[model samples]
Target: MATEKSGTVGKALGLLTLLGDYPEGATAGQIADAVGYPFSTAYRLLNTLVETGFAGYDRREKRYRLGLRIYQLGQKVAHHRGFEGAAVPILQRLTDLTGESSILAVLDDDRFLTVHKVDGPQFRTTTDPGDRGPLHTSALGKVLLACTDPATREHLLETIELTPRTEHSITDRAELRRQIDQVRRRGWAGQQEENDIGMAAVAVPVLSASDRLVAAVALAAPIFRADQEALQAHLPDLRRAAATLALELPLRA
Candidate 1:
């Protein structure tokens, strides 16, 4: 009985998660197929969600989507998380010192998700908060990969699709492993036009008080303005900011 109840709860949560991913909304049949639940079951669950204001259904489109309640809850969680409070000032300081855009990112499953950014007055990057990037190319991604446990890193490297975003992107798994090893040895990571043609970036890990990797702090600039050497030169300041951020983060064990 307990197992049956747990499975039902899991399925309901899975449906909600799937709905959250489809911002444009999806039909009951589509949701049922996606979650591998019976059509009737999916419809019932979606109706229940709608009744609770956790989801909305469009009669004209015959589609279901996450509702205002989810957005409100997400905003509340984001405020309580204090990620912006802890990171914005550091990013601003780093950007001021380096004369480049500074970004804070966290590993989100197989991708790196930028959470905060501060652009230098002279230039700005295309990356923005909520943007997701591949793990093998970006400096922030490399720093995150380097800081993960060996087993987790190996699993991610093997499982993640190594799509080349640009000519400099490392599509070769062995080469990516080598680069991650270098990042581990150097305590930071860098990329020169790897993810984009005219951009360069360097990143250092932000570790918790217990020395657990929590996130990465990165600085990006136009390749003409800052080469790898120039980016590396800013490491001391970046590391200092990262240290301060680590202290500020409320990481859980």
Candidate 2:
């Protein structure tokens, strides 16, 4: 039973992911408090992780950090993502056409993971390739939510805390749901100054051959350079790129 997907094994993996957030390492108590786990359970999981080489403990500081094994597995995952061979060229082409940065993102649990990007001139900020973007404010997040299965999207909307990144973020639940529906109807998503001031974005989904939403590709630029209409005008280009990625990129979902 403990080996079940919802059991301690799963929690331990989640704990391992949480440890990555604390680059400086964390105590068992700190980790427990962060995930609301009991002290005894957290200590046991930490020890098990250490024994399995999934985590490292500094005896002097008594803090735990991600171990070498995680790096090994992460390298393998990066290899499987196949970005260099597949996604990069597509994103680059989209940027070349639109004169804006192109981002490729996937839905990972409750977060939107930025897996690849092609940055245009004067386009570099918080949205790096490895960053985890907020669901309520990002064009990538909105498109993923709109295109995902109804059950998952509903669960995300209910469980995820819509903490506003900026004053323009959609903190109101009803309004956010309405906007998500609009994104669904329009077959693409767009935002202006929702996540960050002076930034605007639009995204289209990369649906699989079976019509499942696999990933999202977005074009982002400064509002001064391209307003909402200008970004939407490039939807033809973005959707073409997304269609190409849908065929090229491997989909686990």
TM-scores, all candidates, are 0.69, 0.70
Q: Any runs in candidate 2 off by more than 4 Å, and if so which?
A: 1-85
Candidate 2: give the clashing pairs: none
Tell me the deviation in Å of residue 62 in model 1.
37
In candidate 2, what are the lDDT values of residues 163-194, reduced to their tens digit?
99889899998988999999999899998899
Q: Candidate 1 on 1-253: residue-level lDDT in tens?
A: 9998898778878989999788788999999999989999999889988887678787878889886556446645674575465579878888877788998887766788777788878787877666778999999999999997677788997888999999889989999989999999989999998999999999999998766888899988888888877989999999998998888865521
**How far out, in Å, is residue 179 in model 1?**
0.7
Instruction: Give, for candidate 1, the lowest lDDT window spanning 10 residues.
Output: 67-76
Candidate of highest lDDT:
2
lDDT of 2 at 225: 94
